[model samples]
Target: MTLVNLATVLSKAKEGKYAVGAFNATDLNTARGIVEAAEQEKSPIILQFAESHSKYISLEQAANMYLDLATRACVPICVHLDHGENFNTIIRAIKLGFTSVMVDASLKPFEENIQNTKEIVKIAQSLGISVEAELGVMNAEDGSGSLDYNTMDDTYTSVQEAKEFVQKTKIDALAIAFGTVHGLYKKEPNLNYERIKAIQNCTDMPLVMHGGSGLSNEEYQQSVANGITKINYYSTMSFEVTNGLRNYLNSNSDAFLFDVDAKTIELVKNNIAEKIQIFGSSNKA
Candidate 1:
């Protein structure tokens, strides 16, 4: 399996040479596309399987499918569990051969988040698995375009809290709140670059940026400069792939639509390859 340790990849990023791509995957095509794009770029990549993905969809089957695809490719790859909340699932991911797992206890109180994350680290560490923990909550928004804290606006995280959390939990990577919200941002995100810099200076671990799908180009560049080693992209790539397939079928329906529609794998791969290139990971692998 191509389950290389994330610590190695993070070390590479620490040198400011090549930033590894971390793509969020929901299904087979998306996972394949991520690995294929990494291979094309000759860069290492982290394939993140989010826990919020429709619940209890056996990781063994998924990891095997994606891991096999990754190993045979020409680049280093890692399987990661994103936003893993439950202990059972985190353990399952480790048992299923995921090299890294994110334990998001951001919504919990400080001490509780620490305990929760520490428990995960303790278990995963013994099993040769890496852990990623989140310090702040990213509020969820609705389709009606409103700040829904009750439903889910923003919860900022402190740089000091981040460092302490990491020290107490011993996680390999830390995802902090720097003003960017999760999912597709409806407005221009006012990312706190200052906070990011502070967190980076405080903690030596690689930083992960959630809600990367809709950030402006300048914001992304700034984030990378400020210490965003891994960016979690889900919404944008998913939309791009789905839209590409739809457009291909509709535009070519009269001619090669049927034949081309059958080529789902290539379509998804090309769609994701476009994203990998745009994210500046094309040749960094």
Candidate 2:
């Protein structure tokens, strides 16, 4: 019965000055590990199913698994749809009982992004669901062995535009691009802490950070200090699990499939627990 919407936990995070970890789960084992980590750490967490990953697990199937997990959990769990690209997917997520949804139209023109986000906000809010919208484009790993610092400014979220977008869309959270990208960074990322502070000053709501993996501890804490209240992390967790599986298989050539699943669950749980501690959400449940 601890299932709740995104706004509920994020509001507490804003007040407490600690960001909640919003981790993406592609399957039941990963989702279960995330919840177990939260329970062990006594922290509130967001379990996300991204639209891009719907190919591996359908939206309907993920919803059923996540809902079952959330209902039986001891701590608050927000089952969220991450990076929902279109109105149809967002609507389907709502019908499937997602507590929160993100409408990502950041690739569109400013006004178009606003209009698209607003439409979803209007619908989702009426049902007591929290909506999140992205204002700037996050770079994806292009195998360049480093982020193109030259184009960083071009992609960073404008402070003024953020204020307007929040006002118009009335979203519960905002994902702003301040130099982070999807997948592993080829080199150390030059995060824009100042930009985050400027946007926070204007919007005065929970701000979210995507591509939150592979940052140093200082970077993560600094982002929180600058007002990032939710961080979407995935790549590093996936990498760690893959490495763990490789090592396990190398040593145990006769390992059963159930044994592999058990190892994955253990690895995922430990990795998430470490992140919970870094996010300063431990014991905050």
Candidate 3:
């Protein structure tokens, strides 16, 4: 099967009561590992790369690799742009063959965020690409000392606004902050399931949950129960592969960095495969 939109994946996930894993890819090997894991599990997956990650690997390089791999892989795969702020970056992603895109205007005011997101939606629509937009902010709130505290923050989206935005923007999916933060969480995030439910009820679009790394499996399940179909994972997968490779290479300093030995690849692959199973996407292809 070819690359599909976020709607199809999330719709299937909504029926299955599971969240599709959107794994962050930094390099060719990283992308390869993600695709390999999904193939092994027979799970459909979205290969994600944020705007910041573009500095290291341009959209061209990453997209080429993902497109090639997806064509050869045994399962459905979607290349997704995660947390991109501007249209320039987003247009580049669309041009690079990304099947899905996320415009994170949560840091901006409501009206401006909507305008910019709507513009992106227009462009992506012309390209037949799925667009995901965020409504609220998910900041890094570390400790009591941090002023960024938002434990299940009720700055949550109102049902009225959600309906208007989805209708105005024509976005394929909506990502609400809920309680999950971007980086690691200092405390267990108590997601606003009620808000998710209200948002899901507000419109028929797919619901996306960010900050997938820090939440517990039970929390993730609750999110799925509340209509979360797409779960974005970045730090978790990076940590998993890096941690595994670090532990393996520590015993042997002769490890080649350019072309990782088969043993090291196995460790990384195993870690990713485990996450694919954990996210309940196994056998989902």
Winning candidate number (TM-score):
2
Output the worst ten-in-a-row residue range by lDDT, candidate 2.
142-151
TM-score of model 2 (CA atoms): 0.98
> In model 1, what lDDT does residue 219 have?
75
Candidate 1 positional error at 234, Å: 1.0
Q: Rate the local accuracy (lDDT) of all candidates.
A: 0.75, 0.94, 0.80
Output the better candidate (1/2) by TM-score: 2
Give the candidates in order of lDDT, highest first.
Answer: 2, 3, 1
Put down candidate 1 lDDT per residue, 137-179, tens digits, no spaces: 7765454678532332247678778888888888888887777
> Please, what are the lDDT tens digits per residue for candidate 3 over residues 1-285?
778777678778878877888888777777787788888899998888888887798888888887888878888888889998978999998988888899989878888888999899888878778899998767665555464444446666667778888888889889886777777666656667898888888787788888788677778878888888888887766666677777778876877765454654565567678767777889999
Off by over 4 Å in 3: 141-154, 258-264
Ten residues in a row with the worst lDDT in model 1?
147-156
Clashing pairs in 3: none
Q: Which predicted model would earn the best lDDT? A: 2
Please provide the root mean square deviation of candidate 3 (C-alpha atoms, Å).
2.2
